[model samples]
Target: MKAVLKRCLLGLATFSLVAAASGAGAADPFPQKPITLIVPWAAGGSTDILARVLSEHLTRSLGQPVIVDNKPGASGNIGSAMVARARPDGYTLLVGSMSTHAMNPALMPNMPFRGVEDFTPLGLLAYVTNTMVVNPSVPAHNVKELIAYARANPGKLAYASAGPGSTNHLSAVLFEKMAGVQMLHVPYKGGAPAVVDTVAGQTQLLFSAGTQTLPHVRANKLRLLAVTEAKRSPLLPNVPTVAETVPGYELSVWYGAFGPVGMPPALVTRLNLEINRIMSLPDVKEKMNAIGVETATSTPQQFAAILHRDADRYGKLIRDLGIKGE
Candidate 1:
């Protein structure tokens, strides 16, 4: 009996030691299972494409599949809400962008979730500029020409947007306000449709992301006028910036990754490191450049700070403009 009790005690001690070791190794062996990256946009969009690209690289590095799930709607709010409600475990992540984090919050008065509060920033993935494109039939070759024509036409000239409260929408709204024109505003379900309509001549103009608009422009379906970026895009260096004609007119779009609120710092750091590594890859940079997107990386803290700053800036702008969410 004494021998049996001693053996039981030894087994208990061994079990405790194993448990402690496992606990210590928890974060180190992170992502033991496949990770689900939720992109709050339709598949094939720039944000979705970026998520897929990063997922591929993360899969190779972590030896686990990184799946992408696109849940697009509500100006990217529905999918973002799903992420906001997801568990803070490292397994579920969000490919959040300025649309969902900054513009949506600014436009929606009764936003379902707070941009900065609802998520733990993993890292900033990329920053890309948008272009203000019009149909070739519009007779506007540049920003100054477009503004002059818009003024002459008043409400006759129309511009399409992905939706109300979307970055695309507010971009036009701000543009109309600042340029002192009366262009009619048309809203669509997504950026693709807006770009398509603009390309097909159903709409005269739209402010669209480089990825969505560049293909059509290159195909001669849409005309490229001015980029909304602060400077000229490497992809379209000849095209001028809107700021060139309208001083202080700069509206850019950016993409980032985040986890649900309260995500483990260890997991966040790991994700940031992997994503930054992928961004540094030449192939990855090349792919993004082809779509006219400039790749960038940032820490979780830095991303969170950006969200806060943009929220405040856009929120004030939206309020001042009386922009309503769709």
Candidate 2:
């Protein structure tokens, strides 16, 4: 009987040790594993560029590898949906944009997820200098000339877009309505291709972020017409704005970080602080600025507010514009 009692006590001690170890493991700090930073665009675009740079800094800040994976297609919905469906443990995150989180739902029929509901806003990342450029061969020197040419040639001025309902698409469509002109919209699968085709003169006009359009503009393959911001960009103050010719024509595009819904509030706060700090770093700012991206940051709540606001604003704009997803 004593031997039996001794064996039972020994088993109890072993069980206690295992239970304690299990509790310790559960209590281990977050990011016990590598995190995936999904960029819902092709590599070399502004989104991918920002994601890579951010992942590098985040890897150091979080003390774990932050991997950037490019998952481009369906106007950024494919990768965004993947992140939306990912486990909300903060292991997976998305480098999403105004279009993906704001405009896509209203634009795309049968959207897979709710932009605000399916994700937790982590932080606002940066704003790109969106520009209007045309093939050098197009006989337009500036926004006024482009509008005049489009009015004269209506539907003859072929414009390129990332896809239907993309920023570039909406930018051009709005330009047409406000300028009282007509242009052919040629939609491509992504921005890079649209820029390439526009440079090659397959399509003549393109309104895209400077990261994609500026290089070709410098190369003389395309002409810089005007910026799509309401105010002239500080980085390119000398450049005129589309609003200068087409009043109230604004297409300010911004990038942001997001995790799946149900992410811990603590985690969201921690990431927002770290990401804002990283964006404010001088070297990081300079790096992004070189690509015409202005690094901006915001609290998680502020970022969420922007998402909700843009979603509503763009929803109305898309509908009023008679935009339909293909």
TM per candidate: 0.87, 0.85
Cα deviation of 134, candidate 2, in Å: 2.4
Residue 130, candidate 1: how far off, in angstroms?
1.0
- The per-residue C-alpha lDDT of model 2 at residue 154 equals 73
Q: So what's the TM-score on candidate 1?
A: 0.87
Best by lDDT: 2
1-326, model 1: which lDDT tens digit per residue? 99999999999999999999998886467777898999877897677878899999999999999999998877778888988998898888898888788777767778889887899988888887788999999998899999999988899898999877778887888788778889898899877788888888889999988877877887888888999878888777888999899888877788998889998777788889998999989999999887777888888888888888888877888888788877
| Per-residue lDDT of 159 in model 1 | 94
- Quote the lDDT for 25 in model 2: 96
State each candidate's clash count: 0, 0
Segments of candidate 1 deviating more than 4 angstroms = 1-22, 25-28, 200-202
